[model samples]
Target chain A: MTGTITEAAGAADASAPRVREMSMQQAVNAALRTVLREDPRTLVFGEDVGALGGVFRVTDGLQEEFGAERVFDTPLAESAIIGMAVGLAMNGWRPIPELQFDGFAYPAVDQIVNQLARMNYRSRGAVPMPVTLRLPSFGGIQAPEHHGESLEALFAHVPGLKVCAPCDPQDAYRLLLQSVRCDDPVVYMEPKARYWDRRPVELAHDPGDMPVGRSRVLRRGRHATLVAWGAMVHRCLQAAEYAAEDGVELEVVDLRWLKPIDAEGLAASAARTRRAVVVHEAPLTAGLGAEVSALVTERAFGALAAPVERVAGFDVPYPAGPLEPQYLPTIDRILSAVQRTLEYKRP
Target chain B: MTDTTERTFALPDLGEGLVEATVLEWLAAPGDRIGRNAPLVELETTKSAVEIPSPYAGTVVRLHAEEGEVVQVGSALVTFAVEGPAGEADDGAAGQAGIVGRVPQDGEAPRRRVRLRPPEE
Candidate 1:
């Protein structure tokens, strides 16, 4: 019976790896453990990281294995946490500080944009700030005030900071490891809504060698290019599936990096499709979607069949739990944007 | 005239208008003597867990809430026995120092008491 069940499951999910299925949160935990084991100079600290193992338990069991010095907790002050990280990175330690939540990171903006980002340049390459700021962001879970937010564009706007948001368990595991090892300070945003989504990931390969600013094409198509990252990537994939029923083939690109965006990969994809649509969970006004759309227009304008489109959240603050659905971009909204781009005609 | 010996240490508003907190653990027992600013109990709120220090330096006569109990703001957490007036000594200490999680600056005014409802007109 066991053999038959295994065979049936294998047939059902051929892409599934032979290894165990892991959630995004579990993948992050595994990645942190791996990095801490490999790098002696690396230290992980943030609020509730020690005995409590973090509020979300992402740092769970890390303190027990790595000891208190390596994995410890700090006072509930975001600015002080980031300032100390800058100091530690300057002194030769690779400090990884967890910001607990997205909205809470506002207090540390001075330290992050001013000190962390400008250190290497201000010192004329004499100093390298290799700090990783882990932020849990985005909405879908009904959390109280300041819990769910997607403020990626804020850090992406900074010149020196490298911003990254991974959508899946595999990317979360790999991209996080890469971010930690990079010489520049990286803002690693984790979509909290997708934390429990499980997938089978190959653990044998090292993701440390993966290029940081490259985009991955999850699906190929000729009609339009759908660019997204973090939770919106999955949403775009679903929209593509929905659009396929009407014979619209949408190429989905997971923009793994936000800052130093994969402009070349995006242009190549847009050039082939001759049309583009950018999607994100942040507000529409000055979100990353605008940046991606502008990049495509500048680089791939000659190949465009229509003006680039964008589907994003409203400009207002992320609404309370009941109204979040309307605030976020749904599959219908993405499909409508894709439909509009497909119907555009030259005057 | 009232004979004032035991004082009730009402749990102060931890700011942000948070209503209640779960008692994670108690650092001092009913019969134990605790110093001012020493952690008396640990409480877990929605944002973070904080060690609440004793406002009065005296012997703890009784603990109002047990571990794992959700205590409301303004509820009596501990009763302490002290010499002289019941509230005079602790009032001065509370004004001078702040709680563990919510520390006040040297020249900053003491936090205003948090009230659940508007005052009567």
Candidate 2:
């Protein structure tokens, strides 16, 4: 299948590609398997990725065919894995290391920000970290502490990292391949909870069609513009579905890449809807949502329907217990923000 | 010992398309009893730490690749000795050469395995 949304919809070629219903994790596995088979240089590494096939079985059976050299296990150390990846990138290899869970990525923040991210800039573009760091992030899985934290904001704050989250299986497959092929380092956030949720995806499109830092308008609306990424993209869609019953039309933009933001798309969306609401898994303060909101307000001040509202995680460390529901963004929360934004009158 | 029990395991492309990877450490050795999906070795690729699972349920008879040596894709990494069903012997080399010939070309753009391409690009 081409995975090209445009081609899939219009092509009169009745011969459709084979389709299978797999979970998000499975889709990711398929993507990895395909890439690894296609590119002999693409390697997968993470804790328990071999015999255990990763704690989530995202890498099951890889070792058998790929052998110990290509598909093996790493020590239970996050920092070491990332640091090693940096070294590998320096030596002309593409590394895709899994952070395991969202919370575990913190241990490697130093290598990520100070070393991997800055290597290219400090070297005056002589060297670049083409490594792709995959993080299974966000809550609702009911996992323990540090497992479902949304830390894209932290990486987004850095200058070098290209942060993105794929909402579905097709995006999971395509975005991952794209990230691996990209020249700059990319932080690919996988929403653990929505691994199995199914939606139709395009088969093929021109490579490099979806550029980094471009926000995709997932759905069109006239009342408000909802800017979101990763898991929240799904939530925003759900919120749009529900709001439709109440005659509320919303424009939803999936901010696929974070660092080099799609300011133009966002500003244009805000111009059409005249209302903006930023949503994310991170807290409002110092979050990417805040940055996006500020950017829209500063750029689209003349076409404002109301102040840009943000729906995001609370300002606290992600809780271990049931508080996870409250820690991350929700559909209701997004809807409420949309309603609030729509209600705000122009001064 | 029957020759039918021996199986040749080809190196799989770990999630990354690394040309060659170093065996950072070996978890299993020759003559070790191994099961399908068992942890055979810990490999350090250019990306991260990873473990290689046993592709065959058998004993490790021959170690083809050494630690710290860069091994290429489709290369033979290990030979497994298996117990055939009901006193029967198996050929380890049979049905494997075809696999080597079918290795997908690297760096092809993403093509959907199922379904047509979407309408709006």
Give the fraction of reference interface contacts each candidate recovers: 0.00, 0.00
Instruction: Compute the lDDT of residue A180 as modeled in candidate 2.
Output: 78
- Tens-digit lDDT track for model 1 on A128-191? 9999999988876555567668888999999899999999988888788889888999999998
Report the error of model 2 at residue A136, Å.
Answer: 0.8
* TM-score of decoy 2: 0.69
lDDT of 2 at B87: 44
Task: Give the Å error, residue B44, model 1.
Answer: 9.9
Q: Candidate 1 docking: what grade?
A: incorrect
Per-model DockQ: 0.01, 0.02
Mind sharing the TM-score for model 1?
Answer: 0.72
Global lDDT of each candidate: 0.80, 0.74
- Tell me the alpha-carbon RMSD of every candidate: 15.3, 14.9
